[model samples]
Target chain A: MTYSIIARCPHTGRFGVGTTTFSLACGRRNESLRPNVGISKSQAFYLRRIDPFVLNLLAQGYTPAHIARLLEEDDPDFEYRQFGIIDRENNVFAYTGPRIGQWAGQRVGPYYAAYGNGLAGPETVEGIVAGFMSDPDAPLEERLLRGIEGGRDAGGQRFKGQRRPERSAWLRVVDRLDWPRIDLRVDMHDRTVAELRRIFEEFKRCDAYYQECSRDPRNAKPEEVVMSELSAA
Target chain B: MTFSVIARCPRSGRFGIGSASYTMAIGAHCDGAVRPNVGVTVTQSAPLLRNNRLALNLLAQGFTPQQALRVLAENDAHYDYRQIAIVDREGAAVAHTGTHVRQACGQRVGGGFVAVGSMLANDKVLDALVAGFESQSRADLEDRLLNALEAGRDAGGLKGSKGPLPERSVALLVWGKHDYSDIDLRVDLQDGAIAALRRMYVDYKPTAEYYEERARHPRNAIPAMEFADMLKNKQKAMS
Candidate 1:
């Protein structure tokens, strides 16, 4: 039902997360952030408290493995939930519920990993994970696209299992390390995974145009108008 | 708890959405992109992923915005708590407001785009938002969303407040064929009651600096900040 990828660009020193689910758009429902500490989580499939609590634990100097232990220790019913973490130290951690589907599995990367269940097929989840790891040296955008393609090619939840056509979302975040961070999401849409891939491939360019929009005088005050409007009053 | 913006690029026929909510950053909870149709969505608050994903699917299949939204909303789980607005590839618009929303919840349907919000005050504030968008016609959807938010503030905002309603945030998104190169803004915070909302709106306005360098997604993609150069340049020229 879900597939997610969290990563760090050791070369760019940037990080990102990309995901899509057969159940719902996880990006629209989850949130996480840390200042060179670690990325946290509060996803819809799991309790919202997990997001901040994990980050808080890391902020308090808990390693990724320790934080995972803490969450598991506190929840007692850890198998019923799912979680993944990647700290600045690149220590990765994850947990999958016992009730997950056959397609569900977790992938551990040097900086991140992918976990999913209720997916279209076994190969489907594997495809997403393989795509991410296939090019460990690729840009975050390309890597994410490959992962999503992996899901789609392996027959992502499209018309399979015959569920209520659940929804899913994508999220990508990084440290803003001089280079800008990639933060994108989609809420409640069909073919969302495909769309997520397409968006990322193009954002690199469009983001530039938006950069120029801010400097245009039209965005300024009346007299300060950088460019005069041709439309008459 | 959430604030966001959606817009289309006349030059490329691309549509986008971006938002920010209380403690929930814009990129994380309410944002996505569809390349084939050149569309993006900024879903916030409860973040209705099913409906949002369904709507996009319908759009890909050539359904009009209105029909797509209707079909998607018919079976939504938390339909009563969701608010949505969409801009089709052709610039047609559609919007929906769930039943159990707050007072100020509403949407302003424009010619090719729409602005929607939830968990607010009375109808006047909503109407004022439309007025604000209209007044800022020269501005792109991002600014129009901001204008609508300003209108929301002008109409006493969240409540008929003597001061500001400090419980909100804002996000702005713009999508296009340029793909990863779109301009979006996702301001995650503010301090006062309206703290979150204001901080989101103002912080992203710098929009330019993000362009000279590379802007990432989930950090700026959900909100479309990377392509800042396009909006400022194109919209400014058109204006």
Candidate 2:
């Protein structure tokens, strides 16, 4: 099962998606982000095509709702698929198939959408939505992570009648660069939410290095930086 | 990003693979380098593209699936993290799932098929795929292969960490006696990749048959319009 959040930071016009699944390579499979277009998450019987289709539609100036409608009309097995798309404008659109597993639902806010299936309960998705909506002051990446953590705290995924944290998780944030500003994953870990938090911490720590390298590769000196230094050096 | 099954038809000596992944074009990524009359191999789960080339090379050199896997495992230090399935030219199938893979990771070698998967929701995914293939002895190879994928999905093939997420991408690669695939169709990116694959196969069958007819009996091959009409007639007849 899975829970994911797709968000667009209004201040930066950046797109980001964070997802965790019981399966491996959640980073590779579930999340799809087009640098300037938007973010799409294909979960609950994920299909590789949904992300690309949604992203392309977003790039073509289709609203998230329009893209979702197109996918719904095209997919015969639409009831089994769950998807969420956030356009560059932060317009959120989401769908949960009728046949999806129990406790499946999605919550869409102004600039974000949080959803999950096979979750511990409705509270799981509720927590994720609340988390994302709660921290407008925080960075998009941080808010995305917090949303995942909130879901985890409320019960991330349930299997065999037991609640368990995600086994693999992924976070991707794209800015002006062709490459991702932050792309982190916990491929296989027992505590996916916690590991994602740590990875984000590391990503923030390395932000200065990335910035320095962007300006001049020679300006990035590893030893001169401190791990505790959170801001740009 | 993907789940795939590769097999050989013992009765017809045909080789085929069906796969689904998140990538837009999984065809090139999961080629498995299938050669007619040789063997087919699929390497996934932290896939090393080099391994696919290596396995194909070994198969072309007449190496047994077991032997090739042994050599591959020995040569790559990171083999423990990879999942590979091989079906030799002789229809001997074998699979290797590295220890580092996610839970419910393993492979099942059946009469004429080898199914392997990693990061799956459960081991039942492989079981359902094999069952689908075996249950349809009278069906065409393509139908059986698609059925197997459907079975895998029905068994909750692959899932996200928090819930059962369906497979994102799907591909079906099949070859008859020819070197090129008779049915090489991919629904590379779609919300219903498997469903799209089935529809594509139906729509492309006449085209595939057109090519086959051209290759085998060029003088008797029908015109494009005629072939399209014939397909429409066939669809009407079936309906």
Per-candidate DockQ values are: 0.03, 0.02
Residue B69's lDDT in candidate 2: 93
lDDT of 1 by residue, B97-192 (tens): 666544456776766656666545556766766676668676665566566666665665553123234433345455445423244444322323
The DockQ-derived docking category for candidate 2 is incorrect
**Each model's TM-score?**
0.48, 0.49
Off by over 4 Å in 2: A1-233, B214-226
Task: For candidate 1, write residues A1-233 as lDDT tens digits.
Answer: 46666666677656667777643224433236554666664321355456767877887888878877777687644655667887877888877776432445676767767766656656766787877778878877678767766766766653334432334456565564312256655433466666555555445534443333222312322211211221121
Residue A94's lDDT within candidate 1 is: 77
What fraction of the reference interface contacts is present in each model, in order?
0.03, 0.00
DockQ of 1: 0.03
Instruction: Provide the TM-score, chain A, model 2.
Output: 0.90
Write one digit per residue (lDDT tens) for candidate 2, span B117-147: 7656788988888887777877777778888
Where is the poorest 10-residue window by lDDT in model 2 chain A? A219-228
Candidate 1 chain A: 10-residue stretch with minimal lDDT: A222-231
